[model samples]
Target chain A: MLAGGHGNSNPNTNYLKSRGLWVAYSIGMLVLHLILLSIPPLSIPMAWTLTNQVHNAITFIVLHILKGVPWIPTDQGATSLLTHWEQIDEGRQFTKTRKFLTASPVLLFFLTCFYTVYEPHHFVANFLSVCLVTLPKLPLFHKVRLFGINKY
Target chain B: MDILEPMYTLVFTELVPSFHVHLQVLLGLLVLWVLFKKSEKPGRPGKAGKSELDIINDWKPEPLVTPVPAKHRGLNAPVTKNQIAQHITVNGVKCLNFATNNYLALVNQQEIDDVAVAAIRKYGVGSCGPRGFFGTVDVHLELEEKLAQFMRTEAAVVYSYGFSTIASAIPAYAKRGDICFVDEAVNFSIQQGLVASRSHIKYFKHNDMMHLEQLLSEQAVLDRKNPKKAAKTRKFLIVEGLYNKTGEMCPLPEIVDLKNRHKVRLFIDESISFGTLGDTGRGITEYYNIPIEEIDLVMSSMEGSLGSIGGFCVGTTFVVEHQVLSGLGYCFSASLPPLLTVGATAALNLMDGNPDLVKELNEKCDQLHRLLHKSETLARYFRISGCRLSPVKHLFPLELKSGTENELQKIVDLCLQDGVALAVPAFQLNDVKFQTPSIRLTVNSKLEAQDMSKCLSTLEKTVIATFKPTSTS
Candidate 1:
């Protein structure tokens, strides 16, 4: 009777609940995704199908929860799952960094507005600020910094 | 000035609430700025604390751990020539000719070298500046034309790398208010392109058409709802001809059909498949028999297959010319080195000359796959796909079989010690994880059967030793 009580009253119940919430949220995302498909004037979907999206959503949800558990590290089931997660994250970061660099022009437009408001009369300050924010995004700027600005 | 009177009134009289509020906000921001200054790092105020050379001399190269004979011995020990490979000697080792990206063995070939040399002599070195800034040379045009012909497209523009190819091209062609539907398994480059653009991007799961369809449907609804607000001209479906990590063929024919029926534009990245697929190594467009016209944009890196140093995108003349002039990569960086361009052009030419290269590559893939499957120790956990070496290579997942990254690393170490180079990938989708852990073995046409057999034997020994329970180090 005592053993059963301890098992039932374990604090991991909250952890499991949180895990369950994540899972449910993932499922809901899949449903939302499905609903998104039905509402559209969508003409052509790419290589990915609705079923694949759901499968990936399920995969991501399960992997995220498992990654948080300490015991997960040693377990075979959780280990490979975690590896896949690392790969995906690495890919995402790589892609994101490049996009951020290219999108600097768009970001500069916002910075320009901010500059106009912050330093209204100082022409040199606004020009320098715009240059500072936009320079690093250009491939030429990156190369110059990497190789030396005076190298050419 | 008239502006001074208004400013004076705001500071002195406080006549307008709007002016008074703006002044107060400005004062608050100045106070916050002063506060932030106090939190910065405190460095020596006057002179350097010590000589830079003195600090440098004191620094020591500390080893992570004392060398372990079973695992790390090879890394530290002086390697002899025979240990690495035949006909290739690097760093005093005749390293096994396994680590090269010379898929068709065309990079160093005499024919390729001659063409490259000829182009260099004719064009001179360097495009001098960005494509937008007098960098476009006759050689560059010739290369682009050749690429268009090879890919069977109307026009093509080259970039520095596969990452730049996608990042630069997609954003140039598509814009904000436009919708781009991407494959979950798409490369980092494609993702970069999407993020750079102002378009609303929807991600579908790996190889999931239904999800993509749904996304399109949703976008259509959104467009209809706000038809007058944001002017969106068209939707694009983007994917790779071959996924980089997973050696699986994309459902190209199906995707093409979808594009035709749905009136959506299709973009394909054929970096992996360019020289390793189809009869003439023309890539997925050829393999699937999809018309070149159906593919609005084609992007690929010449690094992996052609063994060169850049990437390219083929499309309509308008799009290609525009991308050349306005794409961020084209407008920013120096054009490809004349030598690299010539080498790539020569590689493409070689493929045209030797139709059997693809056939030979397919056989190497098959043999390697068969040998791994037949291995007693490796067969249990490792799965090898067929000999075709599809768009991404064969999807032999290491993490899936080893159960953990640590175990996967150990297995990888064993193979490395035995002199086999493998590609270990950390790949993700929609912020989730996945690893197509199998080594990316890029087989060259010139490699002998013995070379492959030796590599396989080393892999077998490594696997057996790693899995053997009783074998003490």
Candidate 2:
């Protein structure tokens, strides 16, 4: 199977199921917050907001926008039309990885709210960002694309 | 900054019960992290005592056996819904099938079907065991005798599967420390055989005689240096009759000449050519009018022309008899079903009776070649390939910049809509780094000139419509 280089399919799902993935993700979130806090002008609240927002934006692009595994041709364009989120666990929901992924953003949002003291502006930004990451993970709108954006 | 005292009080009081799942999740994550660290502890670089554990951890097992195709994928490509024929139903739509390797157009033959039915009643659908066991049905012997008689060889052995015929036949003779000279464009079956043989392989450019000669000469120089070892080592020259990758026919006479000069065993895989080439459908040897005895080994699959399930190898009794024990698939795997064996025997009987069918197939191939190559209409769009009378034809798009773009697939899809089924298979043939994917169309004796014309016109319309005329033109 390695005749075609790098035979791994859905590398994202593989990493998600891996033991240290959530720990690494939490550490990454902490690292992002620390980097933002190190800025001279930023307060802890501002850093928390920025960290959640940055994390959400990256996740939105990666899990939602990116479609198909580029390394192997095994699936024969089966994953071409599917986003990474839709491709996860072959579209099965409520699996451990999906639950963890769903829980992660919500946990980050809770932390952001606590750090920002539930400020209206910070709450809105974190709420929208968390919604962006987690709503697509819902089974209701699993493969539904609104308004044909990135539909191709 | 303020310490957010209200948030701490809120978490301790109001949200404590509500965050039940979260507490368990955090605890689970921490435990998982600790477990992950412990699992990785053996791999620390400074440890000298744990080399054995490191080796076990690092080892990634390669697949040693072929993964049984997941209850799908027939012997060849192009999964069909109904009985395979010139016209096939794919995804509920019947289209003129130019995809399958059914070259002799032996489909829906009442006689062949009758034989299969009769045999099934007598011997059941399966032989149930390998050839040495109860697998050796009466019809299996009959088919082997028929094949040997047809090929004018002293003996023949039938393989339960088409691909296994070549894969097993090669290693039965050529073993480790032996050498194989193979053509570059040979299909995956031949490649599998070469790999299984564990023989030193030297691949020459596809059908390049000079390169083959040069390799032979280089081996000769090595032989001069070590005559004792050279005398013990057997040499094999392997080539496909009509290559599966490209439809290009190997120059058999020249190849035979080379085999004689080099004193190498000439093994020709006539899988696609048998029962499709020559006036009498006797295969590549007959096409060139060369005696069948000249080739040390001839392997032909019954799936293509004979319209059956298995494959067979023809040679002297001494050579083929070795495969009964040495050929892995022959001894280990269940033999071909009695009905399929009877089916192949009937198909051969029909071929022996009807020489006109083979002639008709060649004529159809010629007409296709003429339409695609003689007329300059498709020249801008494609580079026509294969020998003049080759049953298989390829249309490699000259205009397409990259194979990944798959303009050919779009054209195939559009043609399929117009009732013309074509294949641009992600062929498990040849390496992909430099090879351009082409539309593989197999010509059958059953297709009339008008039907083929309609197929080509649909293809032309689709090609023009899919890509810019100027770009393709």
Candidate 3:
């Protein structure tokens, strides 16, 4: 509703497209990093360095485009919503175990990368094994299960 | 095998092929461009020639309007100093002082002066910062502890100014969404406190218990409609021990009963009543025999009875602690001067040593009240109001006239001319409620039987001359 577009256009569509772009970019970068790790000639440390630089560059470009395009959701609306959510959440208490559970997926992904660098392995097999274990725990998939498509 | 060997080898040798790294960087840049173009797919087809900067530069905001100052009636003469007991010099004329609040006549005590002089020689003058900073000194803490012990509260906190004590203490507990039920005829300081709290304020008629109950009942109905909000909203009842404007004692016993029945916190401001009421001058709570713990907060100004500057709030340890961090005046304003604090300490000690001074002051209040009541001329024109034991008394005109205030001001000036001083109530132009225009007389222990008689006779002659009946058929 705040994007300054035609009245007939669905505001939800803009929200969903903006959210979907983030999800797609995160997934694409993860797969590209794994592919780079599979090249036998590239050392593990060099591959990791390249992955981090690429990730920063892609994030900068995506955020710049999202801010300039009028049809995409503005940063102001997201910030307001996040602030409202935080105010509501401040009154409720959450357990330590629940917090740890929410953060486990990111932790697991970093552990798998460390293990692969520490011990030489078949790169493709190790990458596939890590993906199978980490994909379900990704926050994007959990959000989909909890809120469904319309909420995005 | 060594850590230094690995660091040297890494710095000397190229870790990855330069061509491959450049290719990856270019690929990331190309991917970003593609994503940006895709995002633009949903935007409008055409582009404007001017950039967004041009549009922003052309924008203008609305202008602000300046406020006009309110017109005021200027005073005929300004008071100069406390020349002697029960007298002050106004416009270079010595008049019997009935305007000051020095109820115990301790303003110019020799002991207090000696203590103040000694403190100045030791601690110098100002504290130069807020309480939490480097402002607090040994005397400030001693005074706070003494006040707490004097009031029989668990702890107490002192502020730099009298007006800001209540103003800061109210908002320290009550916040934006809270509800405060206030007396309609409270002083300007209490009104300022209510404004700063930003709470939902409902005013009851002055000292009207039935009207206050009606408002409480109405609030109950509204709370029933929104139980969630009701659960979160805190309710408070604020009143003064002896109202500064009317000089009447608040019905504290009835107020405490209502507070219990309605489950509301009670806050009492005893700025005028402290050191001027009760047998030993413990204030309204002692007068009514109410326990100190029953009231949530008790605030008073040292300017009135202590014969010094600053104010204080005495309460339980928990309630008093919150003010250190939350009270705006205490946290931000410069601390009270060490000399004044020591002077107040000496005054409190004198009060503790000589409880007879309070008794003498109480007798003076009664004597003055009796004298004013028995005056035939005053009785014919005005209604004498306020408790018999209150040092402050108010005289309201029985009939209203178009030039009633002008007539009252003329009477006050005549009293000054006759070597007696009387005060006319001054109200802010934009105040929400207007009090009746009246003359206020402050009684002090220093006035003798003859002085009281002389003051009454002066007022009588002035009133008779000003309001003589017109010749009738």
Each candidate's clash count: 31, 0, 0
lDDT of 3 by residue, B1-473 (tens): 67357444533565433543353355345333433332212222354565668767877866684444443345334657654557888777788889888888888899998999998999888888899999999999999999999999999999999999999999877766689999998988888888888788999999999999999989999989877667767899999999888888999998999999888999999998899877778899999999979999999989888889899999999999888877889988999999899988998888888889899989999999999899888888899988888899999999977888878988998998888888998887556664689999998888899888988999989898788842121
| Docking quality (DockQ) of candidate 2 | 0.02
Position A129, candidate 3: lDDT:
38
- In the range B385-446, model 1's lDDT, one tens digit per residue, is 43356523442643454444445556655655555654345454443323345555556667
> DockQ of every model listed?
0.01, 0.02, 0.04
- Regions of candidate 2 where Cα sits further than 4 Å from its true position: A1-152, B1-80, B403-405, B429-434, B469-473
List where candidate 1 sits over 4 angstroms from the true fold: A1-152, B1-92, B117-125, B221-233, B373-376, B385-387, B391-403, B426-438, B470-473
Q: Look at candidate 3 and tell me the lDDT of residue B344.
A: 88
A22 in model 1: Cα distance from truth in Å? 60
Which number leads on DockQ? 3
Ranking by DockQ: 3, 2, 1
Q: How does candidate 1 fare on TM-score? A: 0.58
Residue B112, model 3: lDDT of 94
Computed on alpha carbons, the lDDT of every model, listed in order, comes to 0.60, 0.80, 0.74
lDDT tens string, model 2, B256-306? 998999899999999989998888999999999999889998998888999
Each candidate: chain B TM-score: 0.74, 0.83, 0.84
Per-residue alpha-carbon lDDT of candidate 2 for residues A115-134, written as tens digits (9 for 90 to 100): 77666687777777877786
- Compute each candidate's TM-score over C-alphas: 0.58, 0.64, 0.68
What TM-scores result for chain A when each predicted structure is judged separately against the true chain A? 0.24, 0.89, 0.34
lDDT of 1 by residue, A1-152 (tens): 11113333222223323436545744665575467557556321311133333433344344322322332111112222222222222222223323332233233323332323323333233334434433343334332334332221
